[model samples]
Target: MSGMSSTQPWDVQRLPRADDKVFLITGGNAGIGYFVAEQLSGTGATVVLGSRNPAKAEVAMAAIRSRVSSARVRAVRLDLADLSSLRTAVESMEVDRLDAVVHNAGVALDAPPRRETGDGHELMFGTNHLGHFALTQWLMPLLSTAPAARIVTTGSFAAKSERLDLDDLHSRQGYRPKRAYGRSKLAQMYFGLELDRRLRAVDSTVASVVVHPGGALDSLTPSRPPVHARTTGAWLRMAPAALLVHGKHAGAWPAVRAVLDPSVRGGQLWGPRIFGLRGKPCREPVWSQLTDTSVAARLWDASCDLTGVDLGTIPG
Candidate 1:
């Protein structure tokens, strides 16, 4: 927990020290995940970037080191699209206790010629939701070992209006890039909330918190050369949108707070403060679409079957 007073204002820039803690961020090699890693590493915590590309991961680490002096950071290869390799990846982390894990990485395809993962499931749903689901199950033991652990699922603003069609969860009957992408994120948000309920029911110390980076644009995000670069014209063109939305770094606030904020409770939803689209991080009421327990339970069971992870047996 971070700042507990409901009446007191929270400063998104100021974070509590986490020198002895260990935090893992899936896909921390780029975008919002990269900023999340950079911010946490600045806290003196050991930050492990879960990336699929070793070279890209090292580049991200180097960027962080350049930005933050004495930053404690490293990387572990993690490709959510592959299920068989997850357990091995977790073991490779070589950490006994994990204070927090930010489920921040995902895939979003713009146009469809829909793709499936190595496990033969729709790419977005498989990687965004189920991948994190399996990874969470595998990390339960380490999370349980921490005095107080957090599972920060990076949800999406797109999920606010989408409803799950559990019957055709993979969009086999029909598929649109937009709908599939929305549903995948909605599923992950559901998983995050359901996990909160499960952990509480079991009296576990591990907490699950969901966050969405409002609207973020590549043009708005700052350049960190060799990885991301934006032309001055692009930045200027997007400047008008900046009044409402943010760059990827700003989008990272809510998730960063979820890991370090003492006041943020499990099952809570956080996002940008202005119109749920832009501004500093703030707690928001759970979207009605996200509260359907019946759908959540069904998806939980289906996820267990697909990934072979028993959420019913979540540790601690």
Candidate 2:
């Protein structure tokens, strides 16, 4: 529950030291994700950047190497939009085990008449939630091998506005760009909590933690407002009060805390120290009471059904 002061500014340089562990950070080649990779790599951890774009990943890796010549780092191609790509990426890794898998990759298709993945699920839901769900399921063995493994998912405050509409999960019944994005993120959080429960029940060594960046600048920004997608443009126009809230490095803080905080509890949520929007890493309340047992369990079952993957079957 401890964190940096809410009134103070924080950056990657202030991150806790991480040593002698291996970390795989998705979307780690740019922006907040990039900085997270850089910080962990600097601390002498074996850092792998999970990137969809090879060239961009390479560039980011090169920069990190320049700063820390001994940084044991590499870039692995990973596109969460495709489940096969997720499987292939994990399969391709030569490493024996991973200490943490930071689910930092996400996307928001705001300009939408609604698109679905190859599996016929909504695009946002596929890439943001289902894909990561599958990836985590696939990586259980390697994660279980490590002394303590953490699955740190990047969620959002916008999750407050999202509900897992089981009747219309694909959002085909009513395709709203923003709503789909929120549902996808909410599902990600659901997966985090449910996965934790499953791991505990099985006495698995690995732990699952859900972290929200609160707000951040990233490639996932929607071109147009999804039903409830938060954006600077909207905040600036409709709600000036939101401007007082900052999200610049919200992604970096929660990610660092989730991966590094010894105090982080399984199934606990972390975000900025501020009013749940932005600041330093800190334990925060789950945004919705609906994210409790019934919802998380249902989402877990639905995820296993949708992705055709099961976390429970994996050996501890």
Candidate 3:
């Protein structure tokens, strides 16, 4: 697989059977997350769609059931912006083992003005990085119980242009919306890569992989009942559907591949083949900054400090 070119074919059709596996996807109620859930559930995995909104989660579950009658799926409420909510959500999970956890939920392009989460951290950074950091650490035990688990963190093309300001992780200084979003994504990638290194050092079976969904647009995503509403506006709304290169389902391919592809390895990054805007999933090169161990280690320590959670060493 390593010798294959970037355009090598990979899609939902190639996903392995997951009948005995159990997986959780944060923000699985809509967009790329929703499609990831649908595809995985269709393959017989017991999928937990973690969302902040119960109604939206139920709608996503229904959509999956409607599409795949045999889908084994459920919904759980999870608000990445709230640490209390993250804890409650983890406690409520009944599964004894988690085969994989896909960190797919996050704030997108039009993030609101710089603000703080309930924990007093910047909203974008808190929700996108700190929340997942805490959640993944808290769930480490369950993940270790599985024979071979995976932690899939969703990254973005924006990370290529952003640099992490370690001193100002909260964006206390000048905070542009796009730059903030990029910084959060870069943090996420760093966490995933750092996690893989730590897990390997401890001889753990869990793999940590980062993936980018390219440029998935809600305008191109069909809405499900009871929650999501379809794109309803003038040509401006439909313009994204027509202009964006790929659909939401296609955007999910990279994360899906990260989760299930046997050839994928720990610390690897995946994204679209065509400049990360659109195209099939492929193993993409990591940004030079993300590959720096010193930076990753610093980010890991900072995340533990900010979130007040730690995975310790891998379970024996």
Candidate 4:
């Protein structure tokens, strides 16, 4: 797989026109997902913002329309924590050919005692990894129909410090919020890379890429429509923007690049240019654990078993 180097400067302003393309972004109502939807819609792509809350989705859609008068965007109810909801959301879509699916929805924080999704798996792992795992499987047909489709899974910087424990995949033994979040991210990256390998083996045109929004802070983000309050604490909100926290708009760049950059290929990981926390989108090194083929294969098997969705049999 080819890698993006920091030496090459990528200009977000140069994104090519996406006139008739269609994209579905999970958790597009706020945070980096909202910015990603805005950026894609600005380029003329039809965007579907998937969120669990209808009200929030509507607010996000309104905001997008207000900003880009010509924006073609809509909202759909999608709960990543529930497999049934994911399937229903896909069935409800009118998409004949999906250009890309941005798996951006996830549980960012860990629960003190560890939580489980409706599917009976750890909340963070289930929502972040298993949910996306099932979603991509269900959307394979739409993706395959497109001339060239991309699957951009959002990972995190925390992945660098955490490794998956196959025996305790669900955190049955013990749990820490930060570690749980890291494990989920590591799984996401592994899945993205492994998916790329599988697609190549089947000679399919679909590309799978992993991207991380650097440290994006709500306090630093410019206020927009819908009048939503900042989620950050007042103390941090008042402090000068940290060098590592590059606000939501800048953070969305890596995912946007993974989606639209013609030069980006399957199996490549993209992140911030400055130490993975801030700066423009660029290629970055993945953790060695995430690159382990054996581990990825094992993860793929476990995901299938847990989600009860199989991508292996999908026609190429």
Tens-place lDDT per residue, model 4, 75-160, is: 88899899977778998887888999999998877459778898799899999999999999888999999888899999988888
- 48-67: candidate 3 lDDT, tens digit per residue: 99999998888789888998
Which candidate number would show the highest TM-score if scored against the true structure?
A: 1
Clashing pairs in 1: 1-261, 1-262, 2-261, 2-262, 2-263
lDDT of 2 by residue, 233-303 (tens): 66456444444355333457788877876667788998877777666778877766535788888778888
Give TM per candidate: 0.97, 0.85, 0.90, 0.93
Angstrom error of the Cα, residue 14, model 1: value is 2.4
- Model 4 TM-score (2 dp): 0.93
Please give the TM-score that candidate 3 achieves against the real structure.
0.90
lDDT of 3 at 54: 90
User: What lDDT would each prediction earn against the true structure?
Assistant: 0.92, 0.77, 0.84, 0.86
lDDT of 2: 0.77
Q: By TM-score, highest first, what's the ranking?
A: 1, 4, 3, 2
In angstroms, the error of model 2 at 69 is: 4.3
lDDT of candidate 4 vs native?
0.86
**Regarding lDDT, does 1 or 2 come out ahead?**
1
Best-to-worst ranking by lDDT: 1, 4, 3, 2
